[model samples]
Target: MAQKAPWKTNRRKLDITPLLVTNHCPDNIWPGISTQSGTGPGQNGFQLKPGETKNQTVSEDWQGRVWGRTNCSFNHDGTASASGQGKACLSGDCNGALNCRVGGDVPVSLAEFTLDAGDGHTYYDISLVDGYNVPMAIVLQPLENITLDDIPPNLTNPSCQGTDGLLAPQGYNPYPEYPDFLRTNTSYPLPFDQDVDENKISRWCPWDLQQTPPEKPGDGVYPYPDDNIQRPQFNPCYSACAKNNQPQDCCTGKYNSPSACKPSEYSKNVKSVCPDAYSFAFDDQTSTFIIPSGAGFEVVFCPGARSTTILSTSRAEMLQLSQQGKVDKQATIGLKRASASKLRRNAASTTFRLDRTLLTVTVVLTVVASVHVFC
Candidate 1:
């Protein structure tokens, strides 16, 4: 038997469409794009500040993902700064490069896209398959003179926010003995039942699997003032595969087939939290969404649940503001938060809530307010 060669990049010319990426988080973020197939936007990534937007063009038949990197510090040339050493962001660091050529590190919230996959349509999804770091959403631009009569309701716009924006608030630890599952031939039994409490399923990345952030000031890492919280300090939540690497957790060896591999307790919990987002590798049926081709996309980071007004606005209007140098002004004026009651209205009773102390920390962090060019 001959060995199969690796898939090579195809550099042929491709039709392009506009892509607008915005940062709605109070803090700064570095968005990363890694193309798996077809032509990319040209560069792989760049930095996006709060309330700011970047305009780029992506190939029509592109297959790739977009994710935000948090708590990063880089030199002017885009290399990792001294404080970051060889790594930049605490979550989705890509060898400390401003432009990433590969997918980000685990615990990244990804918006995956496959444009023009079939019948002049695009298939997309928000994936927590690699774990999650931030909230994200994708809205398609309305096509001129074309009605989307055939698009599915779920495909109109896929978003993961509200409780999904949080990272492991429950702090559920499946492993009584840390790193026990990492041993060869050892398997960590699934901790929760399929119908387990919504709050019991951790992201599968207990405190042991969290990525440590640089403690140095100006490194962009945000630490909670009170150390009393039981959750992990850093944001990035590593997947079970990342932490254990066992065949069962990684879907390797005999577990490579879909039948052999199933959702772990961690992924099950994630699915309950964000049904529209991918919880595991084989979570395609419910997680994926489809829309027609010829539509542009708007990817927003930290798109809070209270910001429905901004989200409801058309992509064209937002892009026009970005081009006209009025995005910042509009964001400052039209992006005000709704009432606190309204914000918490849809929250599940079992969902983790930040206490007054954490709320104060968040307020202080917001006061300290502060990327990828694919074209």
Candidate 2:
């Protein structure tokens, strides 16, 4: 028997929707991807500030995850150094640099993905097996085939059957024209179960991971236990049986099989909140789900429980807005034409404000650059 040739496999390049992220937290949290597979190995990892939106692209062959890093600050050395923003982080630190060259430090909540690989179905999941640092969620970018009808917590309504989800209102809407967003919302674990606001499941600091340190210590010294596991300092919510590494606890040795790896107290705690999420390593039955190719994905940190949209319910409001947009465009065009006409009409006599002149020049340059790039 002859082995299959390389080219025989469908080496199609599919564009997974660019990741668009919005940080709802007041404090800035860095978000990054540790892209491990595909031709773009070196081309992964970036940072985002609070309330900032970033658009990114990933290849179909890409295998990696998106995670949020908190309480990190950079220095002149380009390493994570002590600054007013603090150093490294409480969780999800990638070496010392902002761009993660490798996977981030563990105990992180993750939106993991393996695109166009293995069985070739786009696999995605929200993993609590590493333990949760921040409240996170991921939902499919609605394709044309699906409509945003499911009201959340009822996964079968729109039939996101095999996929992971908690049906809530669309948290983030990228396209105004495509307002009917169908997404999968995973149930948050533990303290993240409740809604902080109508829009979100839980606040970023659901419960302080570490006890507050009374130390008004010296420079570069942050408060609390950090990574130290001393008495009273260790996070009470830390993964109990799993972290302990016992066979019955972590589900190893004899308990390695799925049926044997029963949920321990800690695993049950996670399971209670996010019943569908991967609570442990062998919780693969409910953890993994597949999306079709060309479907977009967003791994949002601090995902709100609900989403709000600006699109009006009435046809009247939508019509008014539409007309207004057209009018605005026409007005802008007329103004540009008039300005150009004036410039040509009386080159010597006409006077234009410095600001207006600069604006005109800027618009012309923008148009030229756009043409250059697109054309």
Question: TM-score: which candidate is best?
Answer: 1
For residue 316, model 1's alpha carbon misses the true position, in angstroms, by: 30
What are the per-residue Cα lDDT tens digits for candidate 2 across 1-375? 011111113322443445555454334668767776764333344555544656676665677787777766667555664563544665677776776776766666677777655442455677767665555556555333222121121121111111112223222211121222223221201111222222222212123322232233324565453422122211213454424557776777888887787876556555544544666777765555443334456665544332211111112322322222111345434434543443243334434322211111111221212111101
Q: Per-residue CA lDDT of candidate 1, range 281-348, in tens?
A: 77775566544455567787765331122212233323332233122434423322221222233233
Runs of candidate 1 with Cα error greater than 4 angstroms are 1-16, 145-155, 162-208, 212-229, 232-234, 306-375
Q: After superposition, how far is residue 357 of candidate 2 from its true place, in Å?
A: 43
Collision count for each candidate, in order = 7, 9
Residue 374, candidate 2: how far off, in angstroms? 42
Candidate 1: C-alpha lDDT: 0.55
